[model samples]
Target chain A: MKTRYSFGGDEHVYVEIDEEMSLEAFFIALSLRNAVAEAEIPGVTEICPANASFEVRFDPDVIAPEEIMARIRELEHKAEVSDKRLETRIIEIPVYFQDPWTHETLMRFRERHQDPTGSDLDYAARINGYDSVEAFLEAFHSQPWFVSMVGFVAGLPFLYQLVEREKQIQVPKYLRPRTDTPKLSVGIGGCFGCIYSVRGAGGYQLFGITPMPIYDPTQTVSYLKDFMVFFRPGDIVKWKPVDRAEYERIEAAVAAGTYTPRIAPVTFDLDAFNADIAGTNANLMEALNGI
Target chain B: MAFKVVKPGLSTTVQDLGRPGYFHLGIPEGGAMDRFALRVANMLVGNDEGAAGLEAVFMGPELTFDADTLVAVTGAEMPIFVDGEPREGWSAFVVKAGQTLRFGFLKAGARIYIAFGGGIATPLALGSRSTYPIGALGGIDGRAIAAGDVVPVGEATTMTERSLDRSLLVPVSAPVSLRVLTGLYWHRLTPACQARFFADEWVVAPEADRMGYRFRGGSPMEFVDREQPFGAGSDPSNIVDGCYSYGSIQVPGGQEPIVLHRDAVSGGGYFTLGAVISADMDLIGQLQPNTKVRFTEVTMEEALAARAARRDRLAKLRAALA
Candidate 1:
């Protein structure tokens, strides 16, 4: 990996693990960040691991920026991403495709959209060479996505499909951002998929809505008791297509505080995944079973 | 014990040192824009530097105290008054019970810090009382205090009036030069853009707020034309989504360069050009709309030296007060 290192002023050091986004690069970034976090170097304030890179914020008063950069470089060299079995959880996320709230929202911001006349899903499918929206939906749900980054907004996870570059989905963002987006709105911009954590401004192409809350300030969800946000940088997310009945049922369960995401312990083997993509996906699906 | 809000200014909210270490969760460090002034105001009231205080922007709030309390104002030069009597800025004064504290026009700077002797006493969220208005987190009811709102002030020991030295204040004026360190993606831009960035005088856009300040008038930058990566958008100023540093300046559409402030989304996909050095971050809050700004390039060593200088100056101020 030809990793590039630079200073984000005196307080931060940014390391670009790779110039492009790939699962291989993501694993390396995750491993390197884990090592850095375990090292617990003093003056290191925040460790943010992104899709294909990582950044560290530190107090230069306590430790020189160059010294901290050296520590990170050494950690990068020591992180054996290829050999280590990456600990990850597969979370089953339910989405109601073309849900009423998000459909209304996407319609409301049509003027800001690239194809104002067509719906976001129709435009996306056409651009991606899919004959119909159903085909696009099938392609989207065929494989699980790796949570590469969790940011832009609190609890908003940037998920990339667990597939080769040629098989990945791509779409441009809105020409101008919408003033408001429905909460828990599922959206995709460029090649990354995301869930809107809060209802505010958004530019992503809205596709659906998720009943389960990703961000809860009140900490109502049992899983979110410790922290409001659920998704982490390296977590694996699989979308389960839900009907109106199932969506309403899940909504009821959420309101009753009895629902939690179905999560299963899994080890990510990048080498194995690269070798047998279909086999690895089958294993992941088998592993991810219950709440 | 509390003050009744007679009039809420353009924007006034409770702020403190902020809750750090949560950037990974996309939580911003939404605190006082001018932390130095906030600390100074807190110190004047005999409170810890991180104590919660009121942060007023553009204009100042008018309130009537329910009880006699010690209060101090810092940052913007807004003429404050007790019972219609004008008082000087950057000073701590006592306001008797039922006396109305009114604010006049701001002569300079964009934001001001007002500290009650005992602190604002807003409920702490994730370890700070600072408000993130967009997310509706922290501060009073996760929003700015409005009319008829009674904000509880903590207990405090009143003292004689005190004023800070003129040297301690940040002079708010046009043509402010902000020291910036070249960013991670600066190399991706054409050399002409890099040269134009510093040569041009950027003016603060009217849309500037705590989330970010948009600067217009800078020459549009051109990215090195290349095949766009998978996730990176087709736009020249687009890149693979990544974590953004606080103070990072991202230029979208090569038009207005937006510098992210303390109350901002932690990470985004926009291409960053540079970041304001830590020493100059607080001064960003003092920049009013239409203020001319130049991004002066500085090395990390120089940035550290400037930070040290500010720290030394603050230490001296603390000693002088003692």
Candidate 2:
């Protein structure tokens, strides 16, 4: 069942539906098509979607805000009730951290106060079990993670989130602030991990890079689009690392049309997922002690 | 039939309606800044509303017509001449093959529209001829018009002299006042700041283009530096950059109003203080440097009415043409 709610003298409307429907993307797309067809506005513009919200631009002369809201509600209801399953594609990207010292520095800093006689060093040594740094780098590089690249600028692609444990990796706030960050650097910042496509003033910490070009204007749809990064709410992902040699090999295979990113099949129950979210929020609050 | 560009203006490009259905990929709807003038020029030459035309900015171009063609120049007051004869603007005239069309200084406004009976024959890129120069998409070579470039003309059905009317021409020199509606963030402004915004006049700053137009005003608008993230499922902060929407008054860092234009980005960072009503976009486009502009707030009802009136006026003109 779908429920319709109106706000701001009908300037805005939202349709809440049973979680079973999983039709948010469909509803948004339908709204856009209906706005273009039913509203006789001159140059009706549609804003790119941010998160789950998408906006359509119309000439108020042709259709009132109330009318637009009404149409959206109608479309949302129809989409919610429709018995169609949307097709989604998943993609895997391999990341490589060129500098091992960054992780080593973090590990050493975390252990310094705990063990005056280097007992923590044993723990660190246990964690670093590989014969050599090169062996560790190679071993870590084989894991694949799901990534969604969204926007493009200057032949570079921008992504949304890095998924883990059937949910997005929630990044904690930075301990110390850095003013500038480099492009293609992946880092976690405030509940999200992102890959910076270009050098700019940013907050995320530097992690690593993937051999795949973020964007290439020369290609018909660009590699970002070819990867099928189209994402919806409630998707799951995991991260995998790769070495520079393997990255180059994968790049070559992609160029030769022989490589495809590994994807994991996803299945979920909407009610159960929503319940999990509620329980997780409660737990988070309890753990934080009402901070 | 084509035209040879002798001297392209500061940032001239070919434009028509715009590209659609690609916003999910971060492409902008690149089109004419002053759509009213583009329509008028198209109407004069018996072309469809979305026919490709020239959007010459800041200055005009010196060109030589390769074939006998009926053309009209509209938008902004530029001193134009044909074969050294003083040429009247806004009206269509036949240019004989091999005749030269030269433009002098720009008297007012930033962009001028030039429409030929046969529109420019540039290949449709992403369903538009409008140039998105930043992305190198659409128009001739995905860039502004330059000297020594030859643009081909499309096939056009020649009309009889009876179809041409001098009365159909739109006056290019008239001063325009734009109507506006307060947007979602309008109330975020302090009462005193709002009062100052409405009371004082603003001038078009030197930094104005298809992407955005910055205004020189009495005082800057300040806002709390809250960490406002782009809404859900949005691009990372950087790729989704630049202006958006006509009349979208963006105050980045609580200073200088950057009014977005036709070729604005899909999403942006700055606080969108206001969006100008659709009907007033052309009026805003016609403003010249140092031109005084007052920001008058109108109710949503008034905005709708103004939009209807503007549409009705255009419909009447189209009916007259029919």
Candidate 3:
């Protein structure tokens, strides 16, 4: 795809690979970010990779904005043929669907939703042609998701389903963003799934809540002891739905600092995955269950 | 040396140049909103340009010093008081042990910078003393200063008092015009809306904060209808989630346009029409609520020239102080 490069004021260069979101577009953005970082270009301060595009923030005094754009264009050319294999880890995130916390939060913001009469999960299930919320929930947890980008807020991961485009589940954001979203609320908007890393204003349609701490700046959690952010751009996430009782048990464990996330390292080959999407996902899940 | 906060004014926090390179992880490069003012405050006290200092908004903190120290206050135009005796802004002054520093109502500007001789000695998080309150990182316990908090200060590296000439100061005035370089998703808006964006006058909304500033009182913008892209929301103003640059202006539903600031979210679904130039972001920081502003569009060349001009002014300020 032909990428569009635009300057963000005087300090940043935004490169949009595609108008639509896709794994291919994400890979291209990732490769470009990696290539620019490896080049050790001076004055380039931050390389932010996103769902279908990426941004590079630079110091204009050290390197002219045009010069950085020229270098990035050159780097993009080189990245076209680079290796596509990503060595990443798969993590199991325990979530309690239809949990009371998110349910109450969503109910309060129903005036801003497309369907105020029904819950977010029910509305999503109906629009996606599901007979019941249970069937939709099954479809959601059965497939693993790719951590396409980690942003919007500190440690928040935007997840893309591993399934093909035709089978992708999509939903629109709130008509107007709600002023409040409970922290750790598992929500979906458009074709992306996310966990609110902190309590703040949000627009996503909340369906569940995650007991695990995906972000901890103090590094208090055992799983996040080494790093404050639990999810990286290349990480794969598997949603494991649990009952309310299990959610409380895990929540208690998390509060006591005894929770350890289930993680397993795996290699993701873009070409191989593209060739056999279902087969590749099954293999990846096998690795996760084996751990 | 240290200072005891007898009264923590409306949201005071420690800040420097902030920690960069973490925006990818969704952590904003948070720091003093009025960076030029912070740099000047530090320079007046003989501290490093990026040294940590107190960034107070609307009001100033009542701090009592434990030891004699040189200090300077900048950014907002407010009355500075030392033990009930009026002092001066934009100049370094001596605060003896047990003397309390205070301020009167803010006369102009929204935020103020207070720099000590050796800078605030807050522990660094991600190599910065700047506070990212949303992420609970840096500053005093990763939050704003409160009453009774004993703020620490580094040992006095230099004790000389220096002041900037009144003429050198960047004046905060009404109807501030911010230069914008339109890009990112500028094509999404209608031509009339695009024209209206620049032609309309906007007032700073009360919702303004470190994360972003919202501007209202302008005619609601209209978007050119199109087939919504896959994975994007149905709203005409929504796009596939993407990265947001510092100073990027996002107009959700074409209503109030919000300009993301220092502690902005790294990425979001709302479309950004353009970004306010880096040269004028400091001015935005000093704008108070109800302040009228205009978004003036500029070409890339003009934006670069403005940046160069700002750098030259900073150099002149540094030289004058020296």
Candidate 4:
């Protein structure tokens, strides 16, 4: 796909890989960002990859925006996501769907929702053509989600589903923003999903809760010893639904420093995936087994 | 030597240029709101342009010095006093050992920055001393100053004079014009809303702070609505969550426009108008609640040229002081 490049001021250049949010578009953006990062262009401070787009921040005093723009255009043509030799981790993240904590929070903010009379899940299911709320939750966790960006707040990640566009779950954000969302709460708005690392104002539709800490300021967890944030752009998060008893068990384990995320390494081939999404997803899920 | 805060005043925290290159981690480029004022204050006391300084807002602090040193207060205008004698702001002055420095309620402007002869000797976090209050990781214990707090200071590094040329610095007055480059998401806004955005005079809302300056007294912004794209939220203000360029103005609910600042959040789902040019960020930084301002649209070339002019002015200010 041909990328559209636009200036974000004198210091930043924004590139839109495609207008639509497709896995192919994300791979293209991610590939270009990785290629740009490896190039080590002078004055390039940050290369931020997003959903279907990316941005580059540079010191224009050293490298003019025009120079960077020309270089980016040249790089976009050469950077390849085909047969992409990617190294990434697929992490098994345990989630408690429709937990009491999020249930109460969503109930209190019903006025700020599209359907004030129904629960967020009930409304979501009806809008998405699911037979029941249980069916919606089942479909939601049927496939893994890919981390498209890690921002909005520290350690918070925006994830998009790995399934086809028609199969993707969609929901609107709250009619008005909520003053607070609980820490570690899982939220979905439109086609994107996020995990709130801390208690703060949010506009996403609340759905579930996670037991593990995605962000630790003290870096107490061994896995987060080097960096406080757990997820990065291009990481895969496999949501595993759990009951209250299992959620409490995992929560206790996490607190005692005994919990370790189940992670698997895999290479994503963009060309192969585009050719046969079902076969590729099956392969990717197969690689995730026994890890 | 150090200074002890007798009364920390309203919203006093140490700030410098800021920490860049960490926005992807969701960390803001937290720094002085009025960056140009901080630079001038630092230059008046013979410190590096990026030296850490105190940013006092709405009110001023009363401090007792442990040793004699030179200090310059910039940005907001306030009457600085040594013991009992009055001292001038926007200029350098001497503070003797054990002498107390205080101020009256703010006469004009919203915030004032004071640069000590030697920079504030706070330990750097992520390569800066600027305070990010939300993150709780930089400046004095990663928070605001409090009574009895002894802020560490470096040695008296250089000699100092009274003030810079009056014309070299902005007077920090109200009704400032913010030059904007309307290109980031210009197509998303309806043409009528775009016309109203530039034609109206916006008043600084009372809830303004370092994160963003929310403005009132403008025609509500409306977007060119259609079937909301995937990943974008349902609201008219919604877009696929993307990078929010520092100084990008977002009007949530179409009620008021909030211009992101030095502590700007890196990304959001709102449809942004455009970024306030770097040259005029200082204008909004000094604006107080109820201050009227107009957003003037300019081309990207014009914005870059304005930045060049600002740099030339800063160079002149540095040379004259040298």
DockQ of each: 0.78, 0.12, 0.87, 0.54
Q: Write the per-residue lDDT of candidate 4 for residues A1-291, one digit (tens) a residue.
A: 657777776677888787657777787787888778888889898877778778898877778878888888877755653445457878888899999998899888889988999888899899999999999998888787888888877768999887778888999888888887888999788798889987777888888999988887557776777887898887888889988999999888878889888888877666776688788767777767867
- Number of colliding residue pairs in each model: 0, 8, 0, 0
- TM-scores, one per candidate: 0.97, 0.69, 0.98, 0.92
lDDT of 4 by residue, B1-322 (tens): 8999999998899999998877887877888998889999998898888999999999999999999888999888788888879887778888989999898878878889999988999998788999987666588877899998999988767765678778886564446888887766677788988998999998899979888999899898777867876667667777777777777888887788899988777787887777788888877777889998899898878888888898998899888888
* Residues B1-322 of candidate 2: C-alpha lDDT, one tens digit per residue: 8999998878789999888656545566768888878987787788897899998887888889888888888888898788888766776777778988888898877778998887998988777888877667788878898999999998766642223354644454333344555553554577777778777677778777777777776587744334343322121111123224446676654566767777655444334556766667777677776776666777767777776776777776677665
What tens-digit string does per-residue lDDT give for candidate 1 at B1-322?
9998999898899999998978888888889999899999988878888899999999999999988888899998889999999877778889999999989999888898999988988788899999887767898777898989999988886556788887765465457999999978998788987999999999999988888999998788877888887688888788889889989999876778999998878777788887999999999988899999999999888999999999997898798676
Predicted candidate 2 versus true structure: per-residue lDDT over A1-291, tens digit per residue: 334222211122222222111233323433443444464544444534332234455445456776766665555544444433223333455676653533443334442222334322232233446555445444333222222223333323333332123333323223332334444555543333455544433433345665554443334333444432333323333345677778679768767766555644444233343446445333322322332
Per-residue lDDT tens digits of candidate 1, residues A134-205?
A: 999988887999888987877789999987778788999888879899999888888999999988988889
Q: What is the interface RMSD of candidate 1, in Å?
A: 1.0
Better of 1 and 2 by TM-score: 1
Clashing pairs in 4: none
Q: On DockQ, who's better, 1 or 3?
A: 3
Question: Which CAPRI level is candidate 4?
Answer: medium
Error of 4 at A255 (Å): 5.0
State the displacement of the C-alpha of residue A8, model 3, in Å, after optimal TM-score superposition: 0.4
lDDT of residue B251 for candidate 2: 64
State how far residue B262 of model 2 sits from its true place (Å).
1.0
Ranking by lDDT: 3, 1, 4, 2
Candidate order (DockQ) = 3, 1, 4, 2
